[model samples]
Target: MPKYIVEGGFNFYEELYKSLDDELVDTPIPDDTQNSTNDFNNVCLISNLPLTDKFVTLECKHKFNYMPLYNDLVNHKKKYNTMERKTLKCTEIRCPYCRNIQNKLLPYYDDIEISKVHGVNHISETTLIMNQFDNVSCKSYIAGTCSHEYMCSDGTTMPCTNSMVTLLCNKYYCANHKYFGKMAILKEIKIKEKLELHAKILEAKKKILEEKKKTKLAAKMVKDLAKEEAKKVKACAKAAKVTTHAENIENVIISTQSGCVQLLTTGKNKGKSCSCAKIYQNNLCLRHHNLINKNKPYDGTGTNYGNPEQAGLWVQWVNGQEPEPDTDPDPEPK
Candidate 1:
């Protein structure tokens, strides 16, 4: 039965029981609960805060707070330009995440209520409606927001309409600040980078063309070598055919014993007749006659008709008789 009393004399137990009887429940969720449990999709990728009014959406679908994005762009304009030659322009805007070139950042609107905890302003529907009537095409420069402010040569601070109009050092100044002096060194560096990139591209193209030419030349050489080899093979085949025909003609034998000249038939020498003039019993020359005497019982005495030291073989039939000759010899060798 102890009572907790604090400033303004408020009774904690009395109020707590009264709220419980009224079915009043107080649930306190931590502020970082959403940030810890969910992905950072709803948060700005740049500021790492929740998105609210006056945000910019890039073509890559990444959202950023407007002021931070404008400041980043302004910083890039003052710093070095690292984009490729294709997107090399003074007003080039790029996404910080992917470094992809973007022409403009589209406006992103949220319908959340303005609160001190959110720390963002709420853009009304009337403002959007009036923005349609704005003559300036650039959305970031609308209502003189995110526009460049520079000190002119005449000791005057002037604001530029849009970032589209830019110079070397102080970016996006009006035409009156043209003669405020330019950074010649920065201009030279940019020109040198562009020239080097162009030279590299030309060199790459030249190398590709040279490789193509070499490939074509190699193909042609192989084709010509193949044609030459084919010609040599055809010539060798023709020469072999002619030589075989001449040898066949030289091998035909003629017989003059019975007043009849004909090629041998029905023997091992059927396709090739004898070249000798003298014949044995079957009208075969000594060389062709010896072919039939193989494996026959040999008589001690035999005659080699042509010469004793000749390449012809001689043997006498002991028990077997000579085979009967064909009545009609074939006109052509077998």
Candidate 2:
């Protein structure tokens, strides 16, 4: 005999809804007794079995209460005949209690199959059963529920409910956690902006200082240049004054030498003119010369005149009288 098994933990109503066809007409079951067929052998077998709430049945006339037996059959398809053996002639399924094969005939009758298999009357039970499989939680946020809020692509704030759910952690988060995360991001952005602004300000200040230094250096250079130029002008002026004084002295020397009447005269005033022929050591006539030298003491008592003729002329000139004619002097003995 073929062993009958039924998987209980997995929600059959959800699977039934998932396997349904979209384009199908809603057909209601007839309440007429003649239209219903009953398999007496299957019904007798099911009734004779032990009465237990743990018993579950599949559409293939398989029954199982233990989860291991159902799991072994569903998981190990190569070792289990339920999935691998096509020659068993049990490809079609029928309702265990009602003996109805309407789902097999028309695959679109999923709602009716769900009701007959799981005893579910409404679609809400299917939703509740499916919700049990969703065991995901948000990993991005710590110690809070998901608020489903996020920043949109257009730089605006929007609700995260309609957004695509992330498969990594199911996009679950609390409102407080999401709010704090957003605030942290905004704070980081603000700090970065402030640092950039501070850097720009420092760069501007550095540039200004550099410009001031350049200006100061240029001013100093100009001042130094001006000072050098002034020194050059003063030096040129001094040199020109010295040259003019030297030229004036040179002209005076030339004029005195060319215009003098007594060029043979000696002493400090040698280039001057004189009226008398008898000149003294000074560049003057004997009378003026004797008047200036009269205060000197005489060394000898006799006359010291080497030339008596000039001496006589000097004596007469000093006496303010004309000179007499020349006369012979006494000879000296050896």
Candidate 3:
């Protein structure tokens, strides 16, 4: 692979994809395709999506500082793996073998982010680019050891591939996206993409569940409440009807259960009690009629009937029939 000395502190990747200027010509690429403006511009405008998820391989360094890198990869992984926001700080370490300037490489961020792309963060466009450029690796994984004999994926390797911190990208300044500075950018792009994918799947699942639960629970509760309310309304109506038709009502209703229902006159029968005394007019009980017969029953100051028991005539409220009188001849016109 050709070496590309990366310069930092700006949108170098964007600029590189924009145009391979003559000044940074030494930065290695597969071949100059400046003639293709469209392709160049597209690459320059790298999608904020992850392309691939592969380890960045490199030549080994005799001595290295692992803490800072480890922390960076860890933080980046959160932003990349989940909805967590990641913080990327540039490193000032140089290439061990080539003596080239190494930009900030957050090992911690890369450490956690590079392992995943299966469930949520599956296809990282930038990760793909980085993997293509350099041999990417992880402390928890090993390449060329996919043999069933070693189970590095499960972290249960008999002859474990757990070496000098699962280091990949041993050499820097490589052509393509895995270049020292470019590797970080590519990783970032992948991180965002993966995080998005994970988040999308989670959100979709959550929404579907929420909708289903709401629909089922709300429907059931509403139905139950409606039934209870209907029962209450029916009871209230029955009570109001009883109150309105209390005294004048008769055994008009025949209930299903033979349950005692205070029956009322359902028919259209309008009348007063037949056993009244004052307006008797022959409709009076025996007492008042007898008094009239005697001609002296009320002759004095007070009104009196012939018999005493006539006052106890049960004043039953019966249906009124149109009155029919004997020898009654009506020939009046108003």
Query: 1-334, model 3: which lDDT tens digit per residue?
Result: 6555776646566677768575568786665566554443333112322223422222333222333333334444345555434322233333433444434442323445355431122344565455544554433343332111234677875532322322234423212222444556566777998999999999999999999999999999999999999999999998998877773354333212232121222233223222232333344444335434432323332245434332222111122332222233321111
Q: Backbone clashes per model, in order?
A: 0, 9, 41
Best by lDDT: 1
Q: TM-scores across all candidates?
A: 0.29, 0.29, 0.26
Q: Over 4 Å off in model 1, which ranges?
A: 1-180, 183-190, 251-282, 285-334
Q: For model 3, give the 10-residue run with minimal summed lDDT.
A: 310-319
User: lDDT of candidate 2 vs native?
Assistant: 0.47
Q: Which stretches of candidate 3 lie over 4 Å from their true place?
A: 1-167, 170-200, 242-301, 304-334
In angstroms, the error of model 1 at 202 is 2.6
Q: Report the candidate with higher lDDT, 1 versus 3.
A: 1
For model 2, name the residue pairs that clash. 4-62, 4-63, 5-62, 5-63, 145-173, 145-174, 146-173, 146-174, 147-173
lDDT of all predictions? 0.54, 0.47, 0.43
Residue pairs with backbone atoms closer than 3 Å in model 1 (clashes)? none
